[model samples]
Target: MKVSSCLFNSLLLSAGVGLLAPLAQAGEASEEVKPAPLELDTAFVTATGGATDLKDAPASVSVITREEIERQPVYDLNTLLRRVPGVTGGFGPVGEQSKIKLRGLDDKYTLILVDGKRVGSSADLSYRRDLARQDLNWISPNMIERIEIVRGPMSSLYGSDAMGGVINIITRKVSRTWTGSASTHITVPKDSDRGQTTQYSANASGPLTESLGLRLGANVTRRAADEVEARRDAQGDFMYDDGAGGSKNQSVNALLDWQINEEQSLSFEAVHGVERSWASKKTFGDWGDTIGVSFGPSRLTRDSYILSHTGDWSFGTTKLDAYLNKYRNDLDMGKANSEEKIVEGSLNLPFELLVDQRLTLGGQWKREELTNTNTLGTVPVDYQGTPVSGSTLKGDYSAAFIEDELFLLDNLSLTLGNRFDHSDKYGNHNSPRAYVVYHPHPDWTVRGGVSKGFRAPSLKEGSAGAATESGGRGCGSLRPLGYLTGSCWMAGNPNLMPETSTNKEIGLSFDHDGWEAGLTYFHTDFTDKIEYGPLGQYQGRWWTMLENVDKARTRGWEGTARVPLGDSVTWRTNATYMLESRNLSTGEDLISSPKLSAFSALDWQINDRLSTELSAQHVGKQRGLGNDFVQSYTTYDLTANLALTKWLTLNGGVQNLMDKDLRDGSTNFYVPGRAFFAGATTYF
Candidate 1:
């Protein structure tokens, strides 16, 4: 099957591998057992810039706690998040290239954070390729405390890149006492030709002195390439390219905290990470004949330094942060580097108006610099009769925001917020949001919100000197253009406009003695969608340019439920149903997005030392590259954990119990047939 550019192809071809993690042992038996409470009361920090009950957060939120993480057999962040409502993963040939989508929006619209700080996007620096490895797996699961996921537009508080939502990973805190853990996980597919994966991790946190503390963590992971010998399909196309590629990754982080006084603290942190990926594919001619075979390898390294301070006064809490981050991408042909520096601060003040009110004020300043190999040369000058030359580009932005949380009634609360941002490149933009939360009954909660969000053009997308080759692949149009055949040029448009969206949602949830259920309906109107397409030709050469020429509408319903069957058994499920996800300008449906997706799991506690879980994931029919539909499929997994001793635990599982590979369909994504995994953890 023919596809568009490499980026488009990579976006369509993702893996649905089921990686498992071990769970905690069952609790002791008790007579007249009462069902446990759901996540309604969990402390959530991402939704409102401060800690609040999950049920009270203004936005649709989900939390994955440490206990939940320990009980599952998940090794990667994508696998851990695929079960959440309105969340999906699309990975490239390299399984580690996890591209997450929230509410039918791609990675570019979803803001990723570590401890509520942006992790700067490396994917924005490249064109026609997927370099978004920085999004997921940057931190080891062993060092994580919990994850907070807020879905829908959040620009009113977070500014840009939050049109779809935000995902904040909260790491474990430094303990007063010495504590640490070491773990190893391995996955081996039933088909030897497929890839095999393994990972090792360790973490330690403790007090260094009466007024100081330290925390450290490290992890390493490696995977072998599938179909290393390179296989071809009946049409003489390289099937090996469809197989999961190989990857190697490493990460280390350290943090030190000093208590300045009873009401103040200072902290410093450093993190370093590396990612390597390699694969091979065959070149094809216009006549569908093999031309040559080539191997591609790339590396990415990131380093970050952060200094922060927090102070608690009589009426408010103050926080300040200064951070610097650096990234380098080394491709087989060229190299690119980027640096980001940011200074941000926020204050939360509580007071009594007629009722009660909590006011939050924040401001931020950020600068980004990018230098790449491809932009080092001058433009051809044939297109516009003028040559453009640039090797480095820099951009800066400043933003300020204010929010007020008011309790007007005994059971009702309202939140109003707005943010203003000014950038040298994009001028001035404003985002506004309003939300309400009400407790109709003691066991029920009703919430709704409306928000506006936007995304400014990246440096690589707005620079006339920036250019990328399509590698002879056609544009979005199916029928090939003569001038677009064989190494077409895709240039940047400095006049491009920003993408914007208006989002609305309402949700109702009920939680009573572990019998929990929730349903949320959301709608989004996305305008000025940026796309790379034909501009104008000169000297018989076609030049594609990024332009704001499209609009899209996405509406969906997300539902979640939890039930306690007995004292030792529980069942949980979540599902998403898309009502519409269409590009209004092109009249084409969003590709690779399932209309209905659901995940369910059943957990049983057999004894004090053992626990078992049976899980299933269902992906409904989805639009394909052409006017076709990829059939729906479901995968099952069974995992069990055993506590060998007080400090040692062992677990094993079988993924894809049915081995229902979609090879019969036209789906380009890879689905590993069947896999088995085993793991062990040691705690002190």
Candidate 2:
């Protein structure tokens, strides 16, 4: 979790109950259908970021159902996202440092959410990640209902990290019928030296009363490390891989809902999660010195609390949500430590503005604070070079927005939205979005939109000493997400401005006779791109400061398809190809970014008690995080499920079937060859 000291100023935690839009009617599935297949024609709430039909939204959206989650050979959120077209995850410089890039955009550009509110820190520059991201590892897969993704600018709807897109992890809901399930899995690498991973979880949901319901879930996971023989150093001595630094995480969550009335509802939720990892863990010893040098043992803890109320009465529906989140990241090196806290609230109202049109109005207020200290850290000094102590920093943000969806015809509609945001340090700015969706036929549709997005300067960038903060291998450039690794630091730029970009997209989809396909093309122009260093003679290196000195353009194509093979087999695939990701300011190729990525799966059902699936993925080369000459890799996976009885089922899979050597030089992330796992699920 610790990336850099900037993580204290840049990283943040966000929590909210989320603004849930009202639904027109209840949806019921036929019990006779038994176990139905994945639905591609279903509705989703993340495209427009509200309760809207997927076919009616004017943005490119994809959904991963609970069923799919149960079937995929993945453990974390970033890995799950790679299966989505136009998205890819960095292999890593550090195991936990891996991030998602959408349409060749950096992780900082994408936003992640839990329920309806944001997850992880809003900003984390580095220094052991005082405010590290609320990683998916915190949530139990058994507690999820579904995951929705929007692959395009959505700043007008959700502000900030929406420039690239949004990934919303929706938790399971309270069920009307008493229901619960328990599941566990174990994974073993082809090479025993690589160690193993074991995970388990249980969840339950049902009605406590005619108008009251509750849901509870919990999970525990542990990963063993490895002691592989790495390339030798110049001395000809074999180097040791840091894979020995293993990790453990656990979480407990609860949700209580009260249907106060047919038109009103109240809910309260709580989530507690903690994680521990060590860089010095050794394979031969209980706790080895695998870390070698620098960074040391580390741990991060996070907690979230939320309360929400929604009502649908009179002429419109209204929603109010409040949340508080706290995080602590600690590194034994220099006794580095970072603690962050965030409190937020928002109100939303959706009302009919015309006979066939609806308007949504909303406002939000939030505050972020961070405190961090390291014995080896530098404080801003006086003009006389006297070091001053500054271990705490904070900032406030406020915003108001409006969205109008107007129907021009029964089959044609336009969505227009605008938002204005004010930050104590960066001042105020406005963002706008426009989209038109037209359905020429029930089976065919077209959609397109233009939008603007921006990212506010972090408190570290606006308040740190101009020259006192320094360290890291990437000190020479404004690194993208995960910029700092070693001792890298930068001189603060108080006058720094927010980063900005404009995006345009066009897309079409077709569905008929169990055939579904979609294609989208996008182009984005970025300005005021933020990074460190504008080459200078100062200290014989680039001046490290947050400056608006970069510009660039990117274009790409994304496509997805699903076809039913007979009545028992199905095939699905998604792919993305980026044509360019250039740095106009430096006229150089960009850093780690997705170029060509594709995912395909085939599912077969053998009778009513047995089923199997095969999947493959191919990822093209990408620039190293800060180095030159990145690499490309491909992997395959196989999985199977068998119903032992009405309430019990067996599941298993083999990941990295080809055992392809997967690793990114810039990021410490690596694939330890092929692995196999098996587990069982039981219902009650």
Candidate 3:
């Protein structure tokens, strides 16, 4: 099905953002000193192989600096995402199923990383391919110094899951003096069983000794399960019992930086994160003439651990960086349990020389293994949640890569890169990318790039395991209000080929004064997409199988504008418009991804001691899961900061200030209502 007219929404969004453009034109008030220059030329690492200015980066990128993070009242990744353009955050049918979508793509396509290291995938391994409801809850906001989001394919620099984009979180730096801060915040909802959510965090960074530096941090969050408010089925024919959303998570990270010599240095880091959440679904059952409703729990437990060492050495014009990391994760979902372990090591040497050019050579090796248990946990919460029975899956790969940057002219630069990887599961594959940047004027930069990206088949997708789920709404055998048992099966496809895509994009940006604006258009053509079979009947029962199928095309346009109206007032806005997203094979539209999304933030610095911000997010309508349409909506939020003293500060905010009713048509995700929060922070 074709979605709403993109032209109309694009115009509407552009008009809304256009208002902020004139704010930059507001005449400079007498005696109002010129604001500092915008950070358009700020250095970032994730978009490029190394540090580069934002305007020099090959792909589209956005950054949330520490100052911005501190100003917002966000406590979790999901909430933090809403502050960015094209990303959406809200409730799901089951509170635990809520997620963040990037450019109309779900979390599965968007990879998550901390300090340039990949995190474990939250997609269920055994069966159903269901994603973790809280994909970003494990990250500690207090530990982050900045977050860099790169849009479009980046599989050449990173690997896998970069099909949509990459979110790289950079942690804080250590200081010479003993320093730390503590803060706590709570949110009170207007209504719904979800109740209240609270969070606490503490962090310290300083010198442990003359030659040693250390940073320690910890965070804990608790979200009371929201009680289901509606009982009627979509058809309003029968009553069903559903589940609640109760989540609790805690994490800690430590880092030790040591100085061996002026030319060489080494660091050791460790991170431990854990999360526990529960989700439930109520389905109607009919025994002969009588109709009944039954509910079951889908409990999940996830823990992640990382230990690594990083070393850097410089000899004259040559530099070398080496890293060794061990990553491990464990998951327990109802009757299914899985554990994954990965060991990866790499070396990056940029000592090679070419024809008036610099060449960077890199080599990496990685080993990964997954173990799936057939039985449920000691106490099974859902009988049907068992998947993969019992099996061990393993994959190994090694690769070598090189990137060369050549200056064709004083104002033009060209970059070319390629990597060859051999995988035990999918044999050998190669990825290549080319990018160029031209500066016609000091304040203007033009860039365009194209590349091939791929996502290797996971061990679970190649094993003999399968996940089994047996309940769904609106089964053909039953009416809209009645429940019919329909089972979902996604057995492994050992012969599956790695999913690959051809990604291309180009853009231009203007950065001058205290204002910056940019527009980028991207298109990705994907082949051999790994997807599940349509819901159908097998052996007199309903089921679906995992298979590599379909060709998809996703193309979109993104625009961002930022202007510091004055020292006291600033305006920022970002708008995203997806021209098209569809599955070519079946000719079906990608329904769950919104076609238009936008975010606008207005900041007021009343004084050094007082500041306030108003943020608004708009999400266009789209087809919800098994639905024709979900309505579009807008949300307005207000937040403020008050400095009580030199080292003490207070914060308060109202989320959903308008209290506009919200319900996602795709998954019956209903908003809990307006919320109020207050918090305090102190530093030593």
**Best-performing candidate as measured by lDDT:** 1
Task: Note the Cα lDDT for every prediction shown.
Answer: 0.76, 0.68, 0.63
Sort the candidates on TM-score, descending order: 1, 2, 3
lDDT of 2 at 67: 74
lDDT by residue (1-684, candidate 1, tens digit) is 222344332222211111222223234452322212222325888888567888889999999887667664455687777779998664333422246789888778999888888888677445444434545677878888888899999998899999999999988878777888888877777765676778899998888999899999999988766553334545656553455557787899999999899999999999999877765323333434332221223678889999999999998999999999888878556668889899999999999989898899999999999888764333565245567666788999999999999988878999999999999888999999999999999899999989999998888878877777666553444234445245656777788888999999999999999899999999999999988767656555567777899899999999999999999899999999999988889888776678998999998876656677899988788775457676788899887766556677676777788887765425545567777677777877
Sort by lDDT, best first: 1, 2, 3
TM-score of 2: 0.85
Q: Could you report the Cα RMSD, in angstroms, for every candidate shown?
A: 6.6, 9.2, 8.7
TM per candidate comes to 0.90, 0.85, 0.83
Off by over 4 Å in 1: 1-42, 90-98, 125-131, 228-240, 280-297, 375-378, 474-484, 626-628
Tens-digit lDDT string for candidate 2 (1-684): 122333222211100000011011113221221233222324676655347887887788888877778764245666677789988763422332366777777777887888768765623423533123335567889777788888877888677778888888888778877888888877667665565677888988889999999989988887655544454434544444445456677888898999999999999988887776544333333333344322213566778888888887776777787887776666454333333333433333454455467777777787776555542225445223446576567778888888887887889999888989888777888999999999999999999999898877655556545343455553655445334344444566667888888989999999898899999999999888877663333433334555788998888899999999999899999999888888889886666665788999998875555567889888778765445444667789877766556676667767788888643333343555776777767888
Candidate 1 structure lDDT: 0.76
Among the numbered candidates, top TM-score falls to: 1
The digit string of per-residue lDDT tens for model 3 on 278-313 reads: 542233344222212211123344455555554555
Which residue pairs clash in candidate 1? 20-73, 20-74, 21-72, 21-73, 21-74, 23-71
lDDT of 3 at 593: 64
Which is better, 1 or 3, measured by TM-score?
Answer: 1
